[model samples]
Target: MLWRAGLTAALVCAIGLLPWLAHTDPALTVLKARSAERTPAPETLRAIRDQLGLGDGPLHLLAQWLGGLLHGDAGRSWVSDTEVLPAVAQALGASLLLMAGAVVVAVLTATAVCARTLRLGARRRLGARGPGGTGSAVLAALPEFLVASVLASVIGVQLEWLPALGWYGPQWMILPALALGLPAGAVLGRMLDDLLPAAFAEPWALAAAARGVPPKSVARQALRRCVPGLLPNLGLFVVGLTGGSVAVEQIFDIPGLGRLTLRASLAQDLPVLQSGTLALVALAALVALLARLGVRRLIGPALRDGALHSLHRPTPPAPRVVSLVYLLLLAAVIAFGLPRDPLALDTTARLQTPSAAHPFGTDALGRDVLARIAHGALTTLGTALAVSAAALLTGVLLGLLPRLSGPLVDTVNAVPPMLAALLVTGIAGSGPWTPALAVAVVAWSPLATHTASLLRQERATLHLTATRALGAGPWYLLRHELLPAVLPPVVRHALLRLPGIALSLAALGFLGLGAQPPSPEWGLLLAENQPYVERAPWAVLAPAAALALLGALAVTAAGGARLPRRRRTPTPPPAKPGPAQPPATPGQPHPARPVALTTPTDTA
Candidate 1:
């Protein structure tokens, strides 16, 4: 516990030191902004540093800042020359409120949807158009902006049910909450639907039922058992909400930490950026610690047993086919939308609102937004595909290896993928390929950990032991046994990561660490036109809509709508165990029952 606390403190300190590593001097930047000058002189920089109790050495300044942080002093904002701690405190209050509402909405909605899906499945009545299957698919595919747009159009523009923008009252948070929560809920609901049957079939659950526990109580017990599997994904969902809310907060004009970070990043406000990043790092650390504790508490027995499996349900072919068809249709749209000159500049016609001649209108530089979006779609798709493939390959190879250590695996899994990607990009420098490479590297940790866990579980099976005793080589066993069992789940896991990769890609682009100027990537378009939102809202809205569509399609491709296939247990070897085997029992727990978040269940 002491070591863990010390490591966390070290991590926090490392994050706080990021500003000092920047090419631009934080003190110089502050002096220039404060003086309202294009460039501050060396003497001015030195004087400002002296006034602020800063020094030339980065480590010295970092140590000073850390000391002040212990005393609750977060210093002053570089851009506004105002107190940083107070500003961050105010922003954090709004963000925490937003996060709480979003989390509540996510949990309740997921619970209801999961219950409905499980009930419908138990009845064996879900169809092509059923709410459980089809609705989950659709909702999972739609990105927050697309969902927000549809809601804004219907609930705001058409019915005037709520304000489309701004943070006025508690009521104003509902829309943003829904925007963040709905996707999370959709993902969580699908996970529950797939895992609940197996949970219900666990020995403990069945025993509880046979002992006169009420059906509702039994079901509640089953849910608690299933929750440990959901814990890591739940952590990811929370972090994704906090990170992805940057776009939503901007669209709705919310003054949360997300919005604050966005403004700071764009304006290069070093002090604000430093404080905001520290807050985010702290949030990530807190959530991670909570998730670990939750998992340990809920699944102590299962963890000790080292059990894991994938969901079991009949895999439907229809959704897979439908998703492919949608991808093809999207490709056609991209082909049709490709412009003769996406980069052609026309200053006279700059910042035009949407019109028939210019479907997505023009940007501040007069580049065709429609063309840019189309081209950017291709880039986004290509990058996501590449990253996903790389991540899968790396994860599968690492997972299949026999000698990986548990402590190393745990350390890897502890780092959040987004944070890792950002750090990688920071080191590798900005380029079109940087984000994809960084994301792929970050993505490997979870995938590898999941694969390794599942592989370890598979290796412990009696049949695998028999094969080993019979002198089956590693390659032969891997090829004939493990690969076949593991491939399907790995594929599904990789696909499910597509939507997240898309978001990360866009985020990198927004930060100017991805596709550069004149490239017209969705995120770059957003960064370029955000300041002109009031004058030409269409400029930002168009690319945002495209990003939403792309993310939705990726989600669909991830098998969000697909049903799970049942696992076929191999015929038992001749009984040779110490204890006599009991008669076949219903709801008997499989050795591989308790699953890791990204691990695939065995499906023969």
Candidate 2:
């Protein structure tokens, strides 16, 4: 555990060096930012380098930074020239307070939603058709930024229920908490909905119920069983709280670490950025440690022996209702949802809020928000689908081919996806294809690794060997046996990749590397509307809501929620082949063969 924590710390430090890779001379960028009027001369660059000890190698720099960190010195901000630790200290309390509130809100929301879901249809699978499932899918789809904007607009501006912006009374925290917590709650609820049913179906649970145990008591036992699996998500939730609230902080004008980090990135304040990265990573590491301890305490011996895989796989699904819902959503967005000319400007109505004339209102440039979102849906959803398809196909091809060795695939999987995406985007240059290509390049690694593993396992199966012995060729085996066995899981994996691809596209777009202006991509909309959020919050909220919808549709279509891991027993070995015997006629007696019963002494 200590070594794991140390590894995480090392990873965080390594990540901090990525910016330096992007900018070969980060000192130049910093120096240039300090004085924009004059280009940083060679002399000025040398002076800056000497001041920061920039001539030192990467290891030396890392060591120096680590030493400073241990001494409670995070150096000073490049832009503000204030001590990084002090500045972060000022913001840390606010972020931690906000996160605590968010955690509580998320827990309550998840519990209520999941309980209701379980009560409605405990036996039936949770699907998009169910209200709880649909609502969760929708909520889970929304990114923090969009949720924050909508909350600000509806709760704060229109209804006057809460303050639109600022960190003031407890009421201010409520809206931000809701924005941060609701989506997280939805994710947790969805996971619970998937997990609880399996727990209820366990043999011990069934036996308890059969013995006239109270329903509530039975439920408590089942839920207790779920604790081990669910605990990890809480750690993830904490990590999410540390990093995913940047948009929330920005929208609400809260003095949180997220807001500070965003501001620092924009200003190119290296010290603050590095410090913020380390702080978030440290928080994540601490949460991971706590989660590990909590699991050991809560789960105990069960944690060690719990089955890790399921042998009784579900039957292949037919076209589900969720598929139709996705189609209908796309059709509706294209037909009734879109306004006239999404990109066209109307200077007269610039910066307008939601009104009868324009349902989603107008942007700073007078472009209809509804129109842009409706059109952007096609681009965002389409790109996600394309990238997912490309990745899945690539993974399948590579996995199926015997030429690609396990070590090579493992090496590819070892490369961090984000790092790969950055490298691809850097080489390719920013364009619409950047996000899709970057995602495809990185996403294939996982699918290929999983597919290869599954194929190897399948190859070892007696049935497949028997088929091959019966004169089946490689193509026949691949097409008939391997395809049927591998297709279901592979398809599920592809579907799961869709939402991630969309999120990646949005992230890249936020960094100005995805779909450019006039494209109406959701990420582009978020970036373009940041400055106008005060006046026309609808512009930001509309597209953000659309992104969430698209994400939800993708997830729902992919089977709504992840299924819990089931306990597996080792498969018994296949029977050995016996000597051939002459076949007897139907309904006729066959010749009896002499059989010898042998003991250990008889063999001797």
lDDT of 1: 0.64
Instruction: Give residue 67's error in model 1 in angstroms.
Output: 3.0
Query: Mind giving the per-residue lDDT tens digits that candidate 1 earns over 447-494?
Result: 664565456445644466677789999998887667755665556667
Best-matching candidate per TM-score: 1
Clashes of each: 4, 1
- Candidate 2 regions exceeding 4 Å error are 1-19, 31-47, 55-60, 120-132, 157-164, 168-171, 305-322, 335-342, 348-362, 368-371, 386-504, 526-545, 560-604
For 82-155, candidate 2 gives per-residue lDDT tens digits of: 78998887677788889988999888877876785455334334343323355666677666666787779878
